[model samples]
Target chain A: MISKASQSFQVASPSVADQARLRLAPVIRIALLLAASVIMLAPIAFAVATSLRLPAESFSLPPRWLPLPPDWSNYKMVFQQVPLKSYIGNSAFVTLSIVIGQLITSALSGYAFGRLQFPGRNVLFWLVLATLMIPLQATIIPVFVLISKLHLADTLASLILPALSTAFGTFLMRQYFMQIPNEFEDAALLDGANQWQIFFNIYLPLAKTGLAVLAILTFNAYWNEFLRPLIFLKSIDKFTLPLGLVNLQGYMGTGSISVVLAGVVISLLPVLAVYLVGQRYLIEGIMMGGLKG
Target chain B: MSVQAREHPASARRPRLFAKLTEPSLAGMARRKAAMGYLFILPTVLGIVIFTAGPVLASFGLSFFEWNVIDSPKWVGLQNYDHFVHDSRALNSFVTTGKFVLLAVTLQIFLSLLLAIGVQATRSKILRYFFRAAFFLPLLTSAASIAIVLAYMFHQDFGVINYYLGKIGIAHIPWLNSSGWALITIVLTYVWQQIGFTFIIFLGGLAGIPADVQDAADLDGATGWRRMWDITIPMLSPTLLFAAVIGVIGALQVFAEPFVMTNGGPGDATRTVVMVMYESAFSFLQIGYGSAIAVVLFVAILVVTAIQFRLSRSWVFYQ
Candidate 1:
């Protein structure tokens, strides 16, 4: 059902030469697309290859495309050098908490805004939209102060607490809930089902895709989040994957290029796993959010 | 009056399912429904108030006072705002940020658009999916990880990139060591990870263009660039605007790339506004000045976004 954008930019003319060139256009486009893909993936492949090399071999001229015999020492060295396990655990815990928190808050509010009629529904939604424009960087100073005042500084809870609610997630779910037909709700209403009942039984079950999209996006975001953890968390044990990675690179005096690259590759695995499984949802979320905006 | 008789007027429009309840109970049910609506939205509203709205206002207030977290905040009135007049580093940081946004957003939009168009032009469905997935692969990794890898790859002395260039008889160029190349390297690192986002968005927009439009363009002998410029672009302008606006907003707040790649260094060459804010508040403990910087960035984002929308009115077409 998708249409091509007529990429052959040369003007169409009734000439054999032009027609021959037109026939060659797709081949050229494919070759270009192949190049783009290689460019896009090369850095990551390089990271993996570099991760398996020795310190001396890391900077070797005419860099080896492949690390033959695939040195496992660097991977072991990363764990020895840093509290890599704790970093991963902290990331997973914080990410899961934020995802669960956003799901609940977004779903409930989305249902309210989409299905239920209340006095200030429109105003509240506009307020939510306004929140989307204010990035964390703009408000982080006060957030940091507030967190510290609550004695949450240098804690993972500071990261999880501030990010538990997302304007983007709420808006996304609202769009999903709005798309569902009213007939289902009306039928449930005629059966004497309460709002809670209708929400749990009728709407929620139908909102699986929206929920999945929210969960996957939330997971991806917080799992890789660097800024919040960088600002809030202080102790090395409480550091997330991103922080640990930056730390690894920062201490590169003692750390080898191979070990640092190994840390980078290791940190990417969880996000990579989630992405591979929920790629469709991630794509759907981006398209849906983009089109709506 | 009898309960049913008196309630008959109010309950006349009600369904038979609710016929058994009295007028007061019906009123209570309506009240309960409203409360349920409020209840459902309570957590989100509370979060916004506590985390977003409250902090935003507090940040604005904090901009007016000098506080370093160790002592109580003192009122300085317009002093914090006045610092920007003489603060060369602050001004330079803003200028650097402006340069960064311009370079990153332009390259990102142009490359993603070209790639999206290329992917859309492919006749093979499997290859199209493969290309789209490949382009998006970088986005799956953390920016910290990407920057770390690139920092090594772009190293002047030992980088793989320079190694290859050396093989071709070109001298080793400083990627992160020099001011000029540092910013470009940061942009490249940022765009490499971020292009997938705009690529997917453009792909979605391309998919939405009706086949009939292309067919109609073909009938008029409008092929290739002519069709893209005249018909496809106009139709895709809405999505293009969306991608650009979002792209600009994101580019304006870039932190991780500069943070990990260069740490705002080789003389603050790639330092972003957020980096200044982060360093001021966290590193230097100048919370008030940091708050002022944040407030300015917030206003700049709002104004820029507004301008994008205002300008889009001229070119963005709706089908």
Candidate 2:
């Protein structure tokens, strides 16, 4: 409930001064937030604008914010000059593979940790928690060599294999599974369902929200991964979206910036599409990731 | 632990001796369940062992040897470490990263917090979602793409940013070329790309605060800045710590932004530790030296993270 003072402040008998201050507060707050959002949106807006600008106009003075006759040719030129299709396909394959692998691994492990009983459960859980702080960079060099030793380098396996599981995904799943009421598990046991059957039938179906969150979050990450692909993949045709776009930038270094912007637009399309499709899960995952830990 | 606690009641319902002697099958069932638990966790455990811990040990081993991929490694104990201590470029990279983290993380945390607070002021759901999407959209973008777009915008002669400054009667700033300005340009892009993620985290943090706490503060007549500083900040400290830790750890791994935008540029102005590792191992093929840098980076991250946690206790609060 609102405080008595706040209720009084809102009363019909309020003075002109109180009403003026009251009316101005939210307005100022809204204006400030709107201004900040405009700044945040500016880079993306500029990329799209430049992508549509005439190649020559990109170099013009007081650089144009709106491209008249909206040059669609730059995107076509990007397609011609760089293989956008292969990049997208490779990205999609690697990202999807990782998401699937992570889901299976995380779900099984999370179920084990959250519900199943075993010796050393607490110790194992701590190990999982500790891995959350281990940045991939710390271990990249040897993992690179490991991939090479396995003759997996330059293939999509190099990109997808090492990331097949993540501690964060496991931890997220475990926390969610922990919240499931024990009655479900007890009833399943009473029905004579074995561990795997109970997990697959009862727990997995009940964990749709957690699974959706993990998939969406993992997609955002592996889709944008640059360093791993940059290190692991060698061939141009094999490049993921970010790697291919950077390679294209080098080739287009002496050319107009509009073409690069066009490539940038293409690269961002899937991410934006995914976000629009699953904004709820993506947003919730960020909040869920932070506050839970 | 809670799951373990549930086992006690079940155990207590059985006659202990009979449960053990007559129900040998129960013991078998428990062993089977334990095996299942192990089976469930096997893949993730293997992942950690092979990909995480194994690489760390390999890095420590490789740091002592001088090896390129083309030749067999020759052990040169402490040479890379010796060179690292005197390497001006490596030292400068640390300084560059430090300056950046100091600037960018500070700005990111406070700006996102302020922006979140501003957004929270509104009651309109549509407006809130619009603003949320605007802020969060960049977190979905690759650093390479962001660097490409911003590089063009910060282009010295033909860049839109310079053109705008010129419109306002200010001299053009050499954003990526100048040693002084290049790191700032990198910092700006980092903040722009990442602040939104931090904003959402802060929004979550603020939203997580129980409504009654705010009502209580209001009843006590703690309005405006006093309420925020006294009430909101204390409550939000855990989120603040989280954002700060994440920001610092990520900043320590800075590579792609400088790599894509400036290529650690005009005079190594924006080169980071990872860039050094990258150029050494890949460009120069000095695997040993690169591994040494990687080891140093790993240690640096660990130490910095530890310090951040140690300091967080003074500020971060829990319910």
Candidate 3:
């Protein structure tokens, strides 16, 4: 069916035939990727959908793909039925404090490791990295003891204070700082700037990307943190979102699928918002942070 | 130097300033550097020592004594160890954790590698970005939310999964309720959440691979499975080993998903060692017993990591 010139072209560079044969490849690959993505995202979508559906609409025989009349009441009910606002406030307070504290501590430590020359620098850096391998379960019991002994148990401070320093955060900032040129620091030093001024003015400006990444990561970790809150926070008033959601399960008891889904939706909003706003930085930061540490 | 300085006023001024800066004393500069270094590092050092290192050492010491929060510590050297060795519940948990690790890590690594290959084989940026976001979305979702949603999704009746099964004329399966299937459900959830991470790691490794090596393989008449086995796999070995080790460590400490989803349920079928330790410490108020289990888990992780490092030298090709 081909013309002579075209046939010669195909024969000369059989890659043409190969490309023709591989024309179906992209379609197939796209389909597979789409299918996998759906599988990955299905639960999240279902949570969102179920949250928007009424109690009767949620358990239909042929499950409703879309709610007939979108029920905004579930959102109202979540706030009314649970102490959702207090939990949100508590989570926000703990997460913000921890993020700020961790950033300051990590930046200081990272700059020390990256730029400063001092005795035992290598040894100290190695020690910090060593903590990354120690699983949290290994220290949970003692942490609980320490918290209780200090009478910080049943308070938000227990949640915030213990997480003020992380090995991964230090490692992330150090890697970021190392990428910056020394000329800027030298110039600052020659201009009679002290070390703190150099760090704040020179290093921090260059480390905006690192700080954004750390903020997103720290927020995510702190938001969903359950064990620490569960162990430390005894009162219902002090509970964070995760504990609130779990306690919501107890109130619903059984077959209150709509209410539970509503709670899940409430918990997910902040994280999803953070992700949508900081998507690019989140991905890049994860790639850099995860690979190094 | 003097002749050059004479030719440029700027050079002469710079030397004079440098001389003034350096003339204070060498010892003074040393003292300043030491003070600055400590000032910079003080917060982190104090935080680690008080928060991290203190708890770790306390845990080690607490493992030797029996104490509830309300009671005085009674010295029980190796009694908790003896109890751990003979306890059927502890043994079951150990086995369950091991099984979860083996199944979860194996499937996670395999699926992620396949995803990486699929992503690499494609040239369309749109499709690749879609898959990247899709896989990475679960990583963003909180484990607590995932557990709640998945628990509903796997509901025995009126669940989407069962609806599909009924449409296909198959019987409903109790995913979280049956002892046999409960652990598998948790394992699948673990894989679902973790595939994004493994896929990302693989993608990072894939980007590091040179395009010419793949092109040369194609020129040498390698195609499909041959190309993958001979060229791709060998080149990606370092990433594979890294993923494997991380997967192992993560799997061994698996807690949140199972904790939220099944609560180590259907009659202890999914009781992980961490869950056991958690119960021992908090529920039973047996600090000494929990500490012993924690110590055992630590040693196990160390051994596994050491073995992985040893084994990696032979097969992991770093370029």
Supply every candidate's count of residue pairs whose N, Cα or C atoms clash at under 3 angstroms: 2, 0, 0
lDDT of 1 by residue, B59-111 (tens): 99999999999999999997888996578888888899999989989998888
Predicted structure 1: lDDT: 0.85
- Which has the greatest DockQ? 1
Better of 1 and 2 by DockQ: 1
TM-score of each candidate structure, all chains considered together: 0.93, 0.91, 0.91
Q: Which stretches of candidate 2 lie above 4 Å from their native place?
A: A1-19, A290-293, B1-25
* All-Cα superposition RMSD per candidate: 4.3, 6.4, 6.4
TM-score of chain B of 3: 0.90
Which residue pairs clash in candidate 3? none
| Reference-based lDDT, each prediction | 0.85, 0.83, 0.80
lDDT of 2 by residue, A149-250 (tens): 899999999988888877888888998898899899789877767666778999998988899999988988888889999999999889998899889888
Clashing pairs in 2: none
For residues B236-271, what per-residue lDDT tens digits would candidate 3 score against the true structure? 998898888888998898887778778889889999
Give lDDT for model 2.
Answer: 0.83
Candidate 2: residue B233 lDDT (0-100): 93
TM-score of chain B of each: 0.91, 0.90, 0.90
Deviating ranges (above 4 Å) for candidate 3: A1-21, A288-293, B1-27
